[model samples]
Target chain A: MSFNVIGKSVIRVDGLAKVTGKAVYPQDIYMDGMLYGKTLRSTVPHAYFTLDTSKAEKIEGVVRIFTAKDVPGHNAHGVLFKDHEVFCAQKVRRIGDPLAFVVATSEKIAQKAVEAIEVKYEELPAVFDPVEAMKDEIKVHDGTSNIIYHYKLRKGNIEEGFAKSHVVVENVYKTSMVDHAFLQPEAGIAYVEEDGTIVVCAATQYPHFDQLEIAEAMGVPAEKVKVINPAVGGAFGGREDITLQIHLAIAAVATGGPVKAVYSREESFVAHSKRHPEIIKIKTGADKEGKLLALEAEIIADTGAYASWAINVTRKSGIHVTGPYVIPNVKVDAYAVYTNNPFCGAMRGFGATQVPIATEQQMDMLAEKLGISPVEIRLKNAFTKGSETANGQILTESVPLITCIKKVADALEMA
Target chain B: MKKRGKGIACIFYGTGYGNGFPDVSRAYAELQPDGKVAIYTGATEVGQGAKTALSQIPAEVLGLTVDDIIFINEDTSITPDAGTAAATRQTYNTGNAIKMAAEELKKELINIAVKELGLNSDAGLEMKDGKIYLKILPDKCITLAQIAAKQSEPLRTFATFTAQTVQIDPETGQGAPYWPYTFSACAVEVEVDTETGQVEIIKAAHAQDVGRAINPKMIEGQMEGGFAMAMGYVLYEDLGLENGRIWNNKLSTYIIPTAMDMPEIQNIIVEDPESTAPYGAKGIGEPVMIPVGPAILNAIYDAVGVRMTEIPVTPMKLLQAIREKEKQGA
Candidate 1:
């Protein structure tokens, strides 16, 4: 199929602006009389804290100091659950939980005020491991189990398929928690228009969701809020959740002036979400001909302090546990557990990135035990056009695993 | 001693907010007075070339050049909600929505042309290069600007596209949670320094079923960038967390792969067009990264005959594993 523009490599619409250093990222934005905002987070991971903001309020350029009491609307916001707190009212669940927000006339003043705010806390026991958090003795969230969600998939009978298998390979795999490390740190500017509409300009993956969230936090109608996205540096799923949008909006509305907040590199690391650290135990069985027969896998993921996209991420891991092959009999259990560790949310691959670290190694192990080559074994069991996934989704079209495998293999051979 | 080996891996990924989430994208198309069209959508570009790719959809449908269309996006009040740019969904979801809105606007323009030119029917009419013409007659044509000037009412359209997916049953985890899953594979060759346990990637060959190639160069860029990120995921880029606090929060301490660390990369794009997608294109953003990590790990195992069960396989961990393997072999 030939066309004028669809397939052609037209220059990027954002190319000139980006290359010319003319693109205005959130950090590059500045407004007249804009107050700088900074957050005061908890020093202890789990604690009951008493905040004294009197000194911060008395700072020379300090405009306003906001605590849990100043928030007009709901203090909680999250992508999946409304459990994350805008300000820690009673107990701090994680290390970076916001205890207070300080707005000042300058970034230096804001930093000074944030440092002046005194927090006295009584530390509590914290569980950092997902497996240990599952014991429910020390709950990440009080009065609830730490096992946030569990997803299970059952296909054919596992015992029978394993019994028929000539060789079985089992191993445990682990992946670490990593940062998105997008070039731009979290930054935004928020101000109220003359007609009482709050406008937030930020770097984000979704501006509409930000509008809704900012409105919800301000106890106002959605129509009263507007969000504009400037040129984003990078996201890689890091900007999918809330960052400085809500705090900036709240500060702007309270002070009745334009407010801006830009997280430093350290603050950005402490504030945003990380990729889930996963532990996967997988067992694969194949026949003498190297055809995959059955699989049993268990995955436990640390979702950290709050439920972000844990339900979807772990469920995705469960669905793709069998990899790109037809495993007739499969049993998989995936869990997203909450711990006192840094919160884990969306990343580039969501949950599918971690499973291949296990499934692919299992395939190679099975191939080695069966006296077959890696490429040959995968070819024998790769999903074709009519293959059914472990989750019972029948791929009717565009199932091109074999073609991709062959293309890579052929390219490698040529190289 | 240094050892060399090769390994391969494959993966399949479902696009959008699957599992029966109402993955919807909305867009608006307004025909300007000068025959130019404006597309308004809430899809943020996020440095992924979404604006370029999405602008092409309306341009293709309206028989105009990319420069002829005004791309307005990411303002909540002005543009309709095109969903988030994550989930690798902008091109497929927002592209389809823009295409639909543009198609509707095209139909309205053809109707105006039919009445203005006194055409017998709209069946033989074709739009190309800013003109609506009759295919039967070589020269019976009217400019879109002329039709715009003659219209009594303004020409505008709004469209919404929702991907079809069945929710997986909560208990059984059965049912189709996603529509139009994308597939990919990768092969990598590596050299492992046995004494120090430092592994260097020699070359990487990757292939993805992109459904259709909207822009082959952009797809290649995505593939190459995804490979580098995935390589970092396996070898470097550790957050260094201890008891919930990031010890190495600075960029200097938490090492990401620099340009010097990248290996030679080869991208193979397979165009197996998805029938439901825009121009038969599926998202390749996230799928390209999924297979590279495993392929690199598999190559490491093949090189040294030691299986690494954990990631960000720093030289220290690899050395420890190699020592343990040697102890067992002895």
Candidate 2:
């Protein structure tokens, strides 16, 4: 219980350098002869396009222009799936999809070169709603259904438990798509070392994963790539996926010099992943004594453009749908549907943040119907030691929901 | 006309990459010639105090202050893989890995000290402030640096920690997918302007079972930050996406909470330590934000008898709901 450093509030180890403006973020890093890199993104959401890099290659300071054809290895990278293309070769799924990458002597020249490249495309009909996309009428990907992933959970029996309940409350809840807004926009620098190793310095949540991903996209061994995270501005979950790390690496490998890229605020918003917007339809049943009986819920999430962390996010939703209470009979179906909206991945709370809006409200409604208080109803049904979850997992240790509830209630003078 | 009311919400969240994911972390610890320690890991510190909290673990095991430890992290070549910093896993996963490596180094140093002192057995040996001493006799002590000079090989250790979890059955969705689930509760008092449908939080109270508080100040920082983010999620932050394009891409248009918008917050830390964690500490990063949204929404309903189903409950939407409720009452 008592110790030297375990529970002490020692000042942050990196606090001095950060406070004195001595912390070197990725943008602060400048290498000699570092060419500026920029990507030409698609303007249309859905299209089959032909890229013309002839004009871009003729730019005055443009060193090289990389299209999908120039990729030496697999032209795709994603945290969960390899569905996101490094450069949209033939078809573009989202408005911010990369069409070409340009490395130039200066940032201004890179921008000019990116503008010089042309894309001629045929736009296609797109689905923007997850519910509508689930009909499978319009496919985001060519050969797959619009439903990216679906998870179902069945426990005990929903019908009999619901029939035995004294009261049932049902409502639909919606949560909006939001960004991490981590203050600093994405920036990175990459170059080759003396021993034929490509070193990338960036602001990321996982540098080891970036090393593997960059190596895979560059057609090299994992050891051929090295990633170092500078002083990160912030990353709630936005930097969990690939950003400018791979692009900078590929450009550096091609140019055989350092390549640097920094995303503007607008570009950061359009390029990175957002939190999934969820539509949850939940029905909760409880006995007259305030004990939760059965729960049935349907959750649909919009995983736009590509599947980033959709599978795990939606599965987490289904698993935590019943909240912290003990619901014996449960039937839940969660789906991550593909759409043409901005892609969604991991956020702070992952998938669990959205459902409590409905579940907690239902508990209040149930308490109102049963002529009891909200705190009383929750305390009656909240999980304790040895309680079985909706997923049949037994809560053995550190089950302190009741204690937390009491503490909060006492602080609010509601106890 | 303003009405004030109180509401409460609670949550239980699982830590780490559950559902049979590997969820592993590795760390390396070395004893330098100067007797200072070096801890290497790949856990990225995204301003969440990961480097500070992780350094505390090795220092605690080796009986050294945080200042005496050289923390090296977030580089792929030098540091071993400590997994991603998401899933709130760094403090539990990497902290344990570094502690194990430091424990190994500690055992080796004790062996060296026992041999140098020509003791019959390595008993009652304790390390503190860079000195190895026997428990009963205060005078019998040796500096760790002196022990380091006696070692034939450099003292270095590597350790890896893998969390145990079972994959859920696809058909039934029944399994112990996560271990050591964290719990939290929040209560908020809100004042609602009935005419304009404006809601202001008067006061907020939050309590979390942190498993153990490695740094209480950092835990409070996380709690306050989480409250601000959840407030934005429920009432202010909205990405105006139209036809796949973000219209309000700039921060000026897309609003977030400022310090002035925050109300007085009461953070209550409860320690119900997880037995398997390092120093009985679990992650408090993500769980702090989970209970705020619903608690604020419930408080709004309590203030005014209206149930707003959608998020970022703008004044326009709340006013519309208020008008509808008045119409029904009439």
Best by DockQ: 2
Off by over 4 Å in 2: none
Q: How does model 2 do on interface RMSD, in angstroms?
A: 0.8
Candidate 1 lDDT by residue in tens digits, A110-195? 99999999899999999998989999889888777899898989888999999999999998999999999989999999999999
DockQ scores for all predicted structures: 0.83, 0.86
lDDT of 2 by residue, B46-123 (tens): 999999999999999999999989899968999999999898889999999999999999998888888777776678
lDDT of 2 by residue, A169-285 (tens): 999999999999898999999999999999999999999998888888889999999999999998988998898888888888889999999999989998789999999999999
Instruction: List runs of model 1 lying over 4 Å from the truth.
Output: none
Among all windows of ten consecutive residues in candidate 1 chain A, which has the lowest summed lDDT?
A: A406-415
Name the 10 consecutive residues with the lowest summed lDDT in model 2 chain B: B145-154
lDDT measured at residue A152 in model 1 versus the true structure, 0 to 100: 87
Measured over all alpha carbons after superposition, the RMSD of each candidate to the real structure, in angstroms, is 1.3, 1.2
